[model samples]
Target: MLRSVFLLTLCASVALCASEYRVKKASRASLNRLKRLINEKTEQQHSDEKKLIGVLDDSPLLVRDPTAQRHHDELAVNNLDEYFQGDVELSETQVEILEKEIVESAEDSKARRRRKVGKAPLYKRWDRTRPISYDFASSVPYSTRIKIRQAIQLWERKTCVRFQESGPNVDRLEFFDGGGCSSFVGRTGGTQGISISTPGCDVVGIISHEIGHALGIFHEQARPDQSSHITVNYRNIPIGRWNNFYPVSLSQADVFGLPYDAGSVMHYGAYGFATDPYTPTITTTDKNLQSTIGQRAGPSFLDFAAINIAYGCNQHCGYLPCRHNGYPNPNNCSECLCPDGFSGSICQYVQYTSCGAHIAVSQDSVSIYSPNHPYQFDSNSECVWLLEAPPGGKVFLEFEDVFQFGCEDTCDKSFVEVKTGPDFRVTGYRFCCSTRPTKRFQTLGNEMLVLFKGNRERSRGFKARVWSDVSPIFTTTSSTTTAATTTTTVSTTALTTVAVEESTTERLSVAVSHGVSGKEVAVKSVADAGNGSARESVSKRIANEKKNAHATSWFVLQERTF
Candidate 1:
């Protein structure tokens, strides 16, 4: 499973130490010296929009856990003179920037080959013009080779980067079976060896993750801005491994203006470094999204975007607009990254029937229906309706009849969502998928997006209408009981029939809106509200006694004086 080993680190420390937190002046100086060295070769100044602001300064030495033992499969490389993260081996010049005291030594340490100085920048990306080459060691099984091919295909399908078989004499990646799965970030030059240990490091997602590191992107949570989205439960982390929670500085990263994606394959899981089952090492601000932190289901859309951006693949459009909800793809400038709901060259066409018709509201009121409504909607159909109210006014949406899609936690299978404002950053509501009833919804701004999506599961579509609301709406509710039966009369522009049994004390709410005729009857099936609880009860009663089915129920009606 993707969650099983997602973001699991390779190394384990020997013992826990005392709590010693300090920002050493020498460490900062070391970092500054490395930057100065890189700047002399090629000084690349990122635009403000693409820059990452460092939120936390390097500080406090973390206490390693004393009880934890190292995994037998993991190769201990802590003794190396310089390593950027724990896994990536640094160049001779790069290694010199690390403070000597902090660099631990392993028992089997040897003098590494010293390469000539004057390389490109420390974080120099791979050349997109040239293909990355790789060859498998003889020990690698056929299954592992196939998995590696699949991972490469995934990247090729999404990005412009290509992976080719390494020739005998060329400098390329040499995959070998070793202690544990690990790879250097980006191109380290020459023949770089990526280890994929036998038994444990066999999963395709794990291989893809290591490949991602080799492609130049770091862990998603390693970004400095991640703290705002996810909280590090340092207490639950293994002792001496607190440094794993530390993020890289802003100068060391480029966000490219993308939002922090929890579902990215590069993100660590909630229990990634957890010391115990009950404690989680990572927690999200939105608790519901914690499970998504270490999702290794494959690289997310943003991950693909980041790769294209880093490799300079999205240069074709030259800032041309992609209409509708289309995002420009860095790999192909002429193409766009359109969601499932839309299509076309610029994503102007609505492909999925479930994405219903695109209707723009410019008048006082307008109504919309699902594709082939009165009947069930098509499978995999997604409909989007854009509603724009009068200038300086808000939109009021009322669903005269809404069927299909029972309430669930996330309306994942099928549901409608409302987004408010110009950018639609504020989610108005995700309805028909939870306990919350879809009542009349009013937007806070002039624009609102009503999106309806349906899966293969069939259900009668919804019919809704929206109107401009110059001011906010207010409502009054009162109840009165008659002698014969506990009759409740609800009044509005139209008459709505709602039958409630006096014997059973069930809370029933009935909402009615004014229609074209001013005396029209609005019919809302009992199944649409309370997720069919009321409808089930009515069906049971009808099945038990067929005679009472003919007896009509009375509705309390209030005549509008207007």
Candidate 2:
């Protein structure tokens, strides 16, 4: 597809003869505007080139009523839907512009200096700690699994392994070999691992740690009492520095000395992993575990001791008691604790989709805040941030990509307006990655685009609203407030109609006054239906234009069907 579809909005005054895009929803309203746009631009081009003076110009360089063209517009730009699996190629100049924007955006998004400070840890070392793997969906690190498999092999040299009655629960774990590594175990648990793709170093420690978990070792960060885990007190940090920078919220397990193993494999260098709002950034003191963190690439003595007690190795034992609920409940959590569109403790309720009770659609400027941010994923995730904004209201979707103000990149997004029920539907969206060396829009989650229309399908009971967020692709653990500025004003629903005469030569405007996008066969025009305000504006404008055009009383032969 021609990237000009995007660059044209920037470089040219008229859209191409036609273009291919991503959204699939057939918006009768948006199509109307688009059709007019096509006509206005094309007619100007034809008239300029066919500059025939007067009498000879009877060849009639023409711009006529849109009535007949509404059906034609149906097959125009908006109806062309094809799979977007390949390169949505952009021009060389567009690529340079995009790459430059990405670098600049990164610089601007790096938090304030004060926020960046204290990111390093003062003094810390990995404390050998054993952990239990109650991985619900098997949330094990790739490296951790390697070590577990290796240990099973080592342990099985004498006998077949039986970690689980059903084969070992290894999913997508990674492995790491202990080289001249300076990795040390930490006192708590938050996600931590080396980039190594081997089982010896990266995965070894985790396997031992998870075994510790099977044997029933809780994470060090879950210290029962805040006073026991560390001399310095702070919250948990997941990524970067400053993790655990705030006061940590204690879980039930943390309050009870589940078991303390200084050399257990479960320990991370810093205790920021399990905390909320995550210690904003990485800490300065945070360091990796030394190569000898586990003493011999295995769990510490305490690890074996605890496992022996929790579940007898040869006994096929039952697990030690778990104090907290084993599963996550997305609803019980605060907005800060949840992912973009997820809420509750486990984040099962999708606030943006029908998974939630109702959804509101609105339009606003979407751009990248940081180059490091996966724009597509970030945009897709920015939804939950607005979950409670318009708790109960309709939506008005707009299409514009400007990266001024706080944003860093000009977003190349699309919209697909759906009409599932009366006022229930979603505008689809799919965000692209940096349009750079690799010119591909990286898709993240399900968010598509924003759309607004009344309950055209089922106008009575439930209103299931939907939309998409296609922007860029980093899935960060921060920046959830990018959509607070978005505003969706509900419109007035007065149904006033107006008409115009065909004698007018100026561009006549129409008021699709209510949420409506359709062609006016009587006046070769199409209008977009939307939130009451926009529709009203379109309707009133059309009405006034009709009045002025008819002041000369010319018969409009093409007034009723397009």
Candidate 3:
């Protein structure tokens, strides 16, 4: 009987083992099927996103309407759902405050038609004493998270503001994949959501721009003084979209005394909200700056300065002596936050790039040219030349020879920028076309900064002459001038009037020959009264003479010596 019981127990144990093996096999198969379904769904989502991006690319607007399903539907109505001024998301309280301000402003304007003064817009600033808390939603793509982190790093590096991840139930910024790129301006006391659309809003500059709005900074063109810099062409815009071009009152937006920056990333592009793609909705007062208005290259130097001022970052090192309009750096009090094309501990030197130099100006003019002048310059080259004059003196700059580079409306790709204003913090005059500048540039102070940026397109560079003038003479002169009986000496970069002999003849003949090919570029005869002042005649004769009429050939100029 004991032997029979042992055999029965063995049979039962084998049956239990077989049952367990079959159950394990079925579970493995089920897990494999679940993984396959997940992968297929992910692939489909990616494909749909690609198709959406293709549609978005065809639209002229950079920022899309988060509420609309189709791009064209964005223009269907004047007001977007839950959005202010197109892409700014505002809380109910903030919206109420804005509407009240607008109504009051309209009433005030009606009361004072002769002198319109609108109240400042309401802006809630984030607390600067503590680190800004931020977090990502599960839906945010990993790649987008990386871009947001990079933008945060840049802002932290440039300013004194700090940012960190948030804890549970804390007031923080939540980044999620909204239908389009949008964010609330400044802190809203609770969890503020920043929508960073995938694929469409992946650019670093675009990301930084949205973050800028969240930092209590409005659109550059929204400032009260925007009318002085940019003109809004309402005819090119639809009636419903006119609200996008409305200016924020001075009281509403505090600029911290910074100048209006056309290159600010917050500014709209030329064709923004335009009814016609070829026609621009906005035109800059400074025609050269038309292309610079809507740039997504990141924040301008003044943009950073304004943020520092707004957040009280400038107070940290108020006593620090920073030069060239540079402010003391909040990150390191010992250093300074220098402007573009400027560097050094106190910003007393020119920024060093692949090719550049610190040039000293004297009474005698000196020639400066792009690296490899008279030939095609290298791509991706940045050169900065700091022209410093004696104390109480002024620096004069003139473009002499052929000026050629990659031409764009914005000069985004390649250009030559000259910062001649007293405030070095603002963007300088940029020239990118083949046409040489006709007007000479002079600085208000003793210093001038020249920056040359070259991109993928390599073309013949430029030649310029710089000098120091002690007298305060700020005048614009034509490149072509007429004078009598002058001995013209021309070179590749300079033209010196060796001697101007007094001649009795009323007709003065002048000839300018190219230094390279030895070909006569310009020959002219002028009828001037011999009684005219020698100083006037001598100064007028010295001008840039172009060779071969084509921009490819080198240019020579005649210099005036009194």
Which candidate gets the maximum lDDT versus the true structure?
3
Better of 2 and 3 by lDDT: 3
| Model 3 CA lDDT for position 220 | 80
What would the per-residue lDDT of candidate 2 be over residues 1-562, giving only the tens digit for each residue? 2443343233222212111211122243443333344334323433643221111212111111122111110011111211000001122332343234323432222121111001112111121122221111122344555445676543322211233322121211111222212211221222112122232234454344433332224443323232232322222322222222221122111212123332244433221222432121111111111111112234433343333222223233233321111121112112222222333333333333311112212222222121112222122212111211122333232223321111111111211122111111111121112111111121122222222111111111111222333211222111111122111121212211222221121212211111111211132232222234534544554455344322112212122222
Candidate 3: clashing pairs of residues: 120-251, 120-252, 121-252, 495-559
Clashes of 3: 4
Model 2 regions more than 4 Å off: 1-148, 153-161, 164-196, 199-203, 210-216, 233-259, 270-296, 312-562
Global CA lDDT of candidate 2, please? Answer: 0.24
What would the per-residue lDDT of candidate 1 be over residues 49-131, giving only the tens digit for each residue?
A: 22222111122111212222222211132321122333444444444632231233222111111111111354556677878
Sliding window of 10 residues with minimal summed lDDT for model 1: 14-23
Sort by lDDT, top down from the best:
3, 1, 2
Best by TM-score: 3
Q: Give the per-residue lDDT of model 3 (tens digit) for 456-554.
A: 589887889888874222222122333434333222322222111223232121233222223222222222223356444543433222321132133
Distance from true position, residue 464, model 1, in Å? 15
- Which TM-score value belongs to model 3? 0.65
lDDT of each: 0.49, 0.24, 0.60
